[model samples]
Target: MKNASFGVLLALQFLTRIPIPIAVPWTPDTRRWAVRVYPLVGLMIGSVLTLIAFAMQNVPAPITALAVLSVWVALTGGLHLDGVMDIADALGSNQPLARRWEIMKDPQIGSFAMLALVFLLAWKAVLLWALLAYQAPLWWLLIVPGLGRWAGVALLVLTPCAQQKGLAWSWQQSLSAQDVALALLPLAFIALLAPAALLMWLTVIVFVVLVRWAMMRLFNGINGDMVGATIEGGELWLLILVWSWWQFATVSPPGI
Candidate 1:
């Protein structure tokens, strides 16, 4: 159990910029077990963001939205967003597969990457502003972040890694079907906790399917960049779904 705790901690450290004061042992075994804890790490991120939103309750919606969004990006050090950009660069290159991979690997960001980042950040800000405007429940902040990471776990379990090397393949080799099922237990529990959560859960599954299809069609397999893009895209999709649900719930009749 100590080892499991360490694995969870390791996952938290890896997935966020937050400093963990504990001493952790880095080992092959730990790396494998860490994959299962990603959802937990995501929950931690969501919890922090939710707390931030609550603390800023008196602030104007747009300002609070940007502050929350900034912290959200800072939490992960924009790791997943980097992937989103890289994948966008690769896909927009209009090159052969080999060259596209090269483009993805390039250190410099391209036009497509810039455009994607702008749009993604803008979309997130708009939805967050809406959430704040409605005085949405604090739990709303938790659902999407947690579901995004869960979607990632689903991606890892359901899709094959494109490369033989790197973190994605290493986790793929170590992780199992049973571990994936185990990771989902928290998602089910959370869904049962709130009506919005149920819709978020369903939205996550849909985004996962959409991401899987896009990965297969474009990359022919999955990699870390694809996983990252999936995370960002999953979060966006969840935010859109949740925001829309909140709007409908507020505007519609109680019976309807």
Candidate 2:
């Protein structure tokens, strides 16, 4: 139990800007357990966003959406966003595979990175505004983030690291089949909470498979940047899927 507590703390500290003053031991066991709890960290993020959404219920939807979006970015400290930019820059470079990897490593931002970031943020803000305006179920706010992080965990565990040395490689080395199985507990809990969300979860599975295939073809393997991109993309796609379901489905959203 104590080790699990430390694992959760370590996940929160590494994945978010949330202040966790506990000094977690950086051992192989702790790192493996931390990877197992990545979904929990995401659930905590979703909980914060859900609270903000409810608190601002009376406010203008656009304003509230913007506030939630801002909080989301702040909470994650732009870690995943950085990955999105790196991948964009790499893809836009149009260089050989090795050269593109070099481009991703460059600290300098390119035109493609800037454009991709703007579009991604704009889509998220607009999606949030639409969901808020439509009075969509709040459970979406709870589920998507956790699902997104779980996708990241899946990517990290299932694919080989592109880089020979880095945090992603180290994490891949530490993760075990048991850890991956344990990571699925949160998803099972989510399913029990709202079985209707199973469709959205299915969408994520397809998204991950496609992403894994594409990354393997393009980069020859996965890396931290790819994992980060997967999380951002998964969250956005899930939101879009939920909004589409709400808009066109004859039945009301689940748990409504």
Candidate 3:
């Protein structure tokens, strides 16, 4: 297979539970290319979930929200949520940076992580229900995950990795101007689609900047977990903004 074709499979394999039968060599170049196509993985996830939700449009909003959330988690294998939990544990440790790093690496879930997981998941469900209840455009779902992963890509290229080793370090060290440019093509696609999408892209960029600053202040740099957390955070923010717009627009709001 061509490198581009292989890169697509690699991106899918890395981002979701989807199986890609082709095996691609795991070189730094391949990894960079895979990251370049990361947004495509989001597009694929959003398309499936949007279709499912639309098919069940007649179902109660709360139940539809729960079902979509379940599929979203299963599709990504809770990859970003794990990052959220790790970062929460590290941040809540209140220990020195070194100890906090160790705490992040621990396999056991801490109380902080558990509480964060509960709140984050519940909040996401609530936001999803709001979107469903409002009868917002389902096509916007295609933009949500892409924006989230794009935030991850932004961190990968723009931030310094806190640790001397790990996937983030490797990606940062290997990233090139070309990689950054290629990764951003998805934003152009979003911008051409609608004014709301442009707004969504801007929101993701702003949130990524804020989160990147927080990571530097707390962790001294970015990491795999921080990147993952950024993805989840970006997605949540997009949902909220879309929901808010739907609620306040000239159209009548849906009955709760």
**How do all the candidates rank in terms of TM-score, highest first?**
3, 2, 1
Which candidate, 1 or 2, would have the higher lDDT against the true structure? 2
Across 39-158, the per-residue lDDT of candidate 3 in tens digits comes to 878988988899889999999999999999999999999999999999899889899999999999999999999998999999899999988988888867878888899889988788
C-alpha TM-score for every candidate? 0.92, 0.94, 0.95
Enumerate clash totals for all models, in the order shown: 0, 0, 0
- Cα lDDT tens digits for candidate 1, 37-149: 78777878888899889889988889999999999999998989988999989988888888988898899989999999999999999999987888778787886787788
Predicted structure 1: lDDT: 0.83
Instruction: List the candidate 3 regions with Cα displacement exceeding 4 Å.
Output: none
lDDT string, candidate 2, 2-69, tens digits:
77778888899988998888899887778888988898888889999999999999999999999999
Select the stronger candidate by TM-score from 1 and 2: 2
Report the Cα RMSD per candidate. Answer: 3.0, 2.8, 1.5
Among these predictions, the greatest lDDT belongs to: 2
What lDDT would candidate 3 get against the real structure?
0.86
